[model samples]
Target: MKIAVLGTGGGARSHIAKLLELGHEVAVGTRDPQATLARTEPDMMGNPPFRQFLAEHPGVTLLTFGEAAATADGPVINGIDGHNAVAALTPIAGALADKTLIDYAVPFVYQHDSEHPWPTPWGVMPKLDPCDTDSLGERIQRALPDTKVVKSFVTQEQATVVDPQSVGDGDHTMFVAGDHADAKRRATELLKSYGWRDVLDLGPLVCARGMEMYAHLHSAIGFGLGQQFGGHFGIKVVR
Candidate 1:
């Protein structure tokens, strides 16, 4: 199976590494491949440069966003940052048409003004735009009418998402929501391949509202647990 992961951030790296280990041909998408490769410094999240990651994991091809999306025969994981996702993906909708696009983006407006801003240990918490009325998943689905969009993997860290067994012995649950049953099934199958045993289908892309909104709670839980940044944790939908 050929897969395209559209981002070079830490979260994207987790999926890229896991997919490669599963013997899938992985093509990574970036805004500027040459600029990404030219970077020698670590990113804000302290992730090493993409060049180093590519060196360690040979045979992973890096290309422009459109080219990478076109190369994938199977699912295309949209790991692009939440704020810029719609703009970036909208331009490449042609390449993603008729394909199962498993989007896990939260609609976070990193730069915004509010009279009473929510402050976190790091800084002011980013605001969630289109919160109650709409969601990023629905926005993406609306933008790419020809694509099957499934909202998932937003409730937990990507590392914990790929390797669920590390937390609570894989007893926790995962969720997927989309209008297209077949596309949600594809996302579920991929989750199973990642060793997820309990996957709850949260019916319809509108349910993505809850998933994306959970980002704040996820961060709060991490802070409560004394993890200032990038905490390794998972939440279960006990039933």
Candidate 2:
């Protein structure tokens, strides 16, 4: 399988690494390849530069957004910022039509006062845009009517997305939601390939609202548990 992972962030690096480990040929797509390569310093979150990651993984291809999708023979994973996902992928509508888009983006904007810790974050705060009525995943689905948009990885960070087994006993459950059953199943298969032991199908694209909203708690938990744990846990279903 040839996968196109769109973005040049920590998540994109992890996706490329994991998918490659699963024996899938992967191409990382970005809006600005030059600027991405020019980023010599680590990201604010302390993730290494995308260029460095690309060098480390020689098997992965670097590409412009359109080229990545047009050349991909398999699913295109959404690794861009959630809010910017629709805008980024819309231009490649023809390439993505009738294909499954495994979305790992999250629509979050943190707002916090300076009085907090070294890196204060109110944790995504509240945004009506990614709430019950609308969500980043839903918007992408609406943008590409023919594309099957399955929302996954919204509740986890880059590290967690790649290695679910590294967390505790690895019983934590991942989740996905999409209008198309085939797409959801494909998403689940990919998750399983990456060693995600459990995946719950929440059903329908609208259910992404809950997943997107879960970002708040995800952010809170990261800091709450301290850096040692590193936001590496997934939400599990008790029953």
Candidate 3:
């Protein structure tokens, strides 16, 4: 299966690496291919620039949003940060129509950058807009009503995409929510392919509200772990 993962963040890299590990043809979609490759420094997430990742994985192709989605012919993983996901995808709705779009975004607005949080790797987690009333998943589904949107992988750490055993303690849980059953099924299979052992579907795309809300907890964990901690931890469901 060919997959296109959107964005240049840590999540995107994780997805690309994991998809490659799963033997699926993978490409990355960025808003500006040139700017992404020209970056000289690491990103806010502390991950190396796109140029470095591309060098390491020469087999994977890179393209703009439309080209990545249209060329995929398979699932498109929205690996972008939650806040900018809608805008990034809105223009490519035509390419996503009738396609199973796995939404792995969290609606987080990074704050304290201008106010100067002292050049941290990234900004602290602030409540996202529309999160109180609507979720990123619902927002995407509404924007691309013709697309089959499945909300998933939002609750897990990106590293777990390839190393699920490292997720919490010994095979925890992941959640999937979407109005489209087939989309959820595809998302489930994708998760399983990436070594996710336990994934629970939380019903319709709207249920993403609860999943997104979990971001607060995730943020707290990140803060508690400090900036030096690697981005591989995940929350586990006892059940």
Candidate 4:
């Protein structure tokens, strides 16, 4: 599968690394081609761990946002944060028409303070003003009516999403919500490729509200447990 990951943050990097590990043709999408090349080339060549990882798995190509989206096969995953996701994907909107889009985003506004160790306040942190009521995924779908937007992996931590083994706990589940069954199936396959063992389809895009709220609870748990506590929770099924 040819996958396009759009963004420059940890989320985008993690997805790129995971997709490469899964032996998928990956193209990183960024607004600035030269900047993306400059940023990723060093890590691909200089960073020992990244270099080793790439050496083990070749075929990951970095491209500008437009090129990546224009060339990708099937679904394209949006790894950018809520704040920049729309703008970053706007250029590729036409290309993304009628394509499945796996929207992975959390409404998290970073509020850092030296005196206060926490990155955000106790309540829910609003990353995108538009996501306060409706989620970014829904907004993206609204923007590109032809594009199938399926929301998933928003609740899981970046480390957990990339390297689930690092958690050392039980299977970490990811929730997906989208109206289209075909799009959901595509997302399920992609998530499985990324080592997601358990995934629950929470009906349709409207269910994303609950999923986003669940992320808030997860964040609260992380804050309460402190930074050192790095583990995820999963729901077990008994038949």
Candidate 5:
């Protein structure tokens, strides 16, 4: 599959690495090519080397976010942080028409020196912003009504997102909610390819409100626990 990951953050890097591990042709879409290259080089320096690394990993490519989104054959995963996701994707909205978009984002507000206490150790949690009333996924869907937007992978930690094996016990489940059946199926397949064992379709784009709330709840749990507990949550399936 040809997948384009949008962003240069940790989530974007994780998606790129995991997609490569799944043997997919992955392209990182970043607004700044030089900056992305610089950021990614640190991990490869003095190992097999950047040039040699590229030779070995020919499937991974980096392109301008717009160009990559315009040319993607399969799903385009939005790994950009919640704050920048809509704007970053705005330019490519037309290109994304009738395409499947895997939205992995959270509407988090970063408040420093404010009266409200931080929700998590990371001082970030999903807070209702002015546009978030309809939920971020729904807002994105509204912006690109033609594009099929499926919300998934928002609750899990980046570490657990890539390696569910590290979570231990049985397995962790990620939630999927979207209005399009075909898009949900595609998102599920992509998640499975990245080694996600359990995926629950919560139904429709509106369910994104609850999904985002779950992310907030997870953050609250981490805050109460006084640590970054990203992979500590799981689902109980009862017959």
Candidate 6:
């Protein structure tokens, strides 16, 4: 399958690498392919430039967001920055029509004045907009009525998400929720390819509120575990 990974960030890179290893052709999307490839320094997240990544992994194509989506043969992974995702994706809705879009973005508002700020090692924690009342997944589905949107991979770091066996011996649970049953199945199939044995279908895209809202808790747990940065852990829903 030719998969379109729509970002050049660390999370998107993880999916791209894993997809390539899975024997799928990958085309990465970015706001500006030239700018992304021209970067000599690391990104804010410390991930190397896209050109370096492409150098290490040959055969990967880098294209504009619209071009990448239009070329994908199957599922599209939405890894665009959470806050900017809707605006970036809306213009390319036609290319995504009728395709299963696995969106794992958390809507974070980085610049906000919180009366009671939750400070983290990096800075104050970013607040989630459209948080409890609505979610990023629902918003994307609304914006792209023709796309089958599945909310997933938001609960863990993308690295852990693509390699479940790295934590708890692959015993942890992954969740997927979407209005489209076939889209959820496609997401589950991708998760299985990632070695996830227990994927919980939480039913309905509304459940994405919980998944996206869990970002703070995820950060809290990371802090508690003394992991000041990207948390390398997973949660299991044991019945």
Top candidate (TM-score): 6
Q: Worst ten-residue run, lDDT, model 3?
A: 112-121
> Model 5 off-target regions past 4 Å?
38-58, 112-114, 119-126, 130-132, 224-226, 229-233, 237-239
Q: How well is each residue in 1-239 modelled by candidate 1, as lDDT tens digits?
A: 99999999999999999999999999999999999999999997899999999999998999999999999899999999888999999999999999999998778887588899988877889899879889999999999999999999999899998999999899898999999999999999999999999999999999999999989899989999999876788888877
- Model 6: per-residue Cα lDDT at residue 110: 91
Model 1 CA lDDT for position 147: 91
Q: What is the lDDT of candidate 4?
A: 0.70
Q: What C-alpha lDDT do the candidate models reach, one value each? A: 0.93, 0.81, 0.81, 0.70, 0.73, 0.94
Comparing 1 with 3 on TM-score, the higher-scoring candidate is 1
What candidate 6 gets wrong by more than 4 Å, as runs, is none
Highest lDDT model number:
6
lDDT of 4 by residue, 95-165 (tens): 89888888887654555233535445443243434445787778778877888899987777665776655
Each candidate: RMSD to true structure? 1.0, 3.0, 3.1, 4.8, 4.2, 0.7
Better of 1 and 5 by TM-score: 1
Q: Taking the candidates one at a time, how many backbone clashes does each contain?
A: 0, 0, 1, 0, 0, 0
Model 3, position 225, has a per-residue lDDT of 74
Question: Candidate 1's error at 141, in angstroms?
Answer: 0.7
Clashes of 5: 0
Model 6, 1-115: lDDT tens digits are: 9999999999998999999999999988899999988899999888887899999889899999989999887799999989999999999999999999999999999969999
- lDDT tens per residue, model 2, 73-105: 778898888668788889888889888998877
Whichever of 2 and 5 has more lDDT, that candidate is 2
Q: Which stretches of candidate 3 lie over 4 Å from their true place?
A: 112-124, 223-231
lDDT winner between candidates 2 and 4: 2
Worst 10 residues of 2 by lDDT: 117-126
Residue 229 displacement in candidate 4 (angstroms): 9.5
